[model samples]
Target: MFLVALIFIIISYGMVDSLRADYAEKWQLDFQDPATPVMEGIINLHHDLWFFLILIAVFVLWILLRTLWFFDRSRGTVPSKVVHGTVLEIVWTIAPSFILLAIAIPSFALLYSMEESTDPAITLKAIGHQWYWSYEYSDYTTDSESLAFDSYMLPESELKEGQLRLLEVDNRIFLPTHTHLRVLITSSDVLHSWAVPSLGVKVDACPGRLNQASIFLKREGIFYGQCSEICGVNHGFMPIVIEAVPLKEYVSWVSSQIQI
Candidate 1:
């Protein structure tokens, strides 16, 4: 009865609204709703693995309880001297091997899919600084035109109503929904990480190395993230905001930026 109730609670937790960030909720119990295809795939894989985890946990707990109940001092006067059976050993070994194989197949498929970024429509170069992020939009403006900007964390005092403290930024990276994007990440100083949980993006930013990742937006919304790797004193202040919009709005935003 307890196990059934636990499962029901988990299912109810996942069914809650995922589009908006729930600041008041606990972290370990829920996953922020996914906005991208990669995030969706990740959520699916996590639920798939949970099934195996629950099965193994229940089996181990049952074995432990059975042993304590049947073989305790109050229940047994003499210890059994039987050795391990060959059939039991073979079954344990083969069953685990098959279970592993079942897990590996889907794991490999998801890994390969992440690496497969075909024909990207836009490319964004993100350079990490000691405590902020700068981005350049490629494939939109010509060589003479400059389409770059710095994104700094908005101080708590400047944040308006409903804005998240330490998570909102002055400038947001914008992109169009249903478009494939290639993001090149690097660091100007120490090591940093470009991470956003909703987008399923977490690429390391090395000083002299360029790391690439793919992002495909399935919907239009505001997504937030922070630096995953600790680089300096204000690492927590470096926030990332992505404003995904429609294609027409995105083009207009580009034109306005170019004009500015």
Candidate 2:
């Protein structure tokens, strides 16, 4: 009976792990699995900061509890008349500065990496509308036409089996794995942010001004995101989907689009 129960538990855990694919789950507290190096860095930094946070929280709680227990009136203990110690003041101040320094070093390194430019194999231009997203593959053009398409969220009524509601889009941006990609973003109407948690990408879309970000997908998967900024009434309807495929598959897709 014990062996059977252990096998059942293992199977159940595998089922739950398989269901979590590049999208947010219900009541999820942890981040989705990272698909890019940038996201992996972000998660690592988060874990490092959490270690410090937990240590600080526990130390503060211990101080509070110890004070309450020793200085309580019920304990008949006398409070010390001494107010402040210079050593304690300096220790607290200097210790926090060191902690801030430690946190800032890695943060600045990650920020610099995110802004670093690379010789991209593909350039994708994303334009934000009031309630939708449009993508253009500017690098691959057919003399007079470029590969461009508008992506809109699929309504619940039209959703197919196993499709995630509100996260599914009619058109998804196709990218190639292990290739450096440059994404240029701007807005036609209002402010919108293109954000994908698993990819560690979130850039603001401002009218008349262009913003760029670099992406290098480490794996092939379907990642989902929504408009992070509030633009208008239908802001929630704008969803972003990216389908990463192998290099050969991506070439085929580009050829197909050009032929069309």
Candidate 3:
């Protein structure tokens, strides 16, 4: 019974670790859990590239080892008069070309998919300031007043139990799952970046220029990100949190916000 309980505990801990990827973890070696299709594709492409990289690395290592073994100084082998082999050179060149072609095809395909424009059901505008983010729901307005709010990181004193220290925010961007959403990012002052790894979005927020990206949430969770670009002294304090909820819950939240 004791052994069974220990095994169960280990398995449970591993499962929890794998599922908790919305926020940054200590000593994290992999990407955060994917909450959108774009992130899923990004992870898949990364794995595919790793496969090719491993193959190339192994082949190079084998060639190096073979050469070292065959050309050892102790063996005193006679040197061949041939300077180079055309067949060998051609094989190395043509092999890389084919490998490059294989890599390029999928890379281009993923890039196109990422840049493809789509009609969005909801559009949100994010404006970055010195140390905080301002969001506006451009799609919904009442009496010329649109739903907008500023998100600031919660200080350590204000954080509750189980809340992340630098990652928690007073207000989080709430959106509906399985909905096509467009986010327009720009800066009110210096350059900033609106990045959320789970959603696979990293758009530069530049002054006088607006950048747009598409997001389609596939799950419900709180995803966290930080300003990737160095904007000011408090850039590290500016964090982003997004909460994906069901359609009905999102609508209710929206209604409540508009009322406020």
The top-ranked prediction according to TM-score is 2
- Which ranking of candidates, highest lDDT first? 2, 3, 1
Those runs of model 2 whose alpha carbons end farther than 4 Å from true positions after fitting are 1-20
lDDT per residue for candidate 3 within 50-107, as digits (tens), equals 9999999999999999888988989997668999999999999999999899889988
Residue ranges of candidate 3 with Cα displaced over 4 Å? 1-21
TM-score ranking, high to low: 2, 3, 1
CA lDDT, candidate 1, residue 48: 92
Inter-residue clash pairs, candidate 1: none
TM-score of each: 0.89, 0.92, 0.91
Q: What TM-score does model 1 achieve against the real structure?
A: 0.89
TM-score for predicted model 3 compared with the true structure: 0.91
Q: Between the candidate structures 2 and 3, which one is better when assessed by TM-score?
A: 2
The list of candidate 1 runs beyond 4 A from truth reads 1-28
lDDT of 2 by residue, 93-175 (tens): 99999999999999999999989999999999999998999999999878877899999999999986567889889988999
Of models 1 and 3, which has the larger TM-score? 3
Per-residue CA lDDT of model 1 for 155-227, tens digit only, reads: 9999765677788789999989999899999999999999988888899999999999999988877788889
The most accurate candidate by lDDT is: 2
lDDT of 2 at 73: 97
**Every candidate's lDDT:** 0.86, 0.91, 0.90
> Could you tell me how far off, in angstroms, the CA of residue 1 lies in candidate 2 after the best superposition?
14
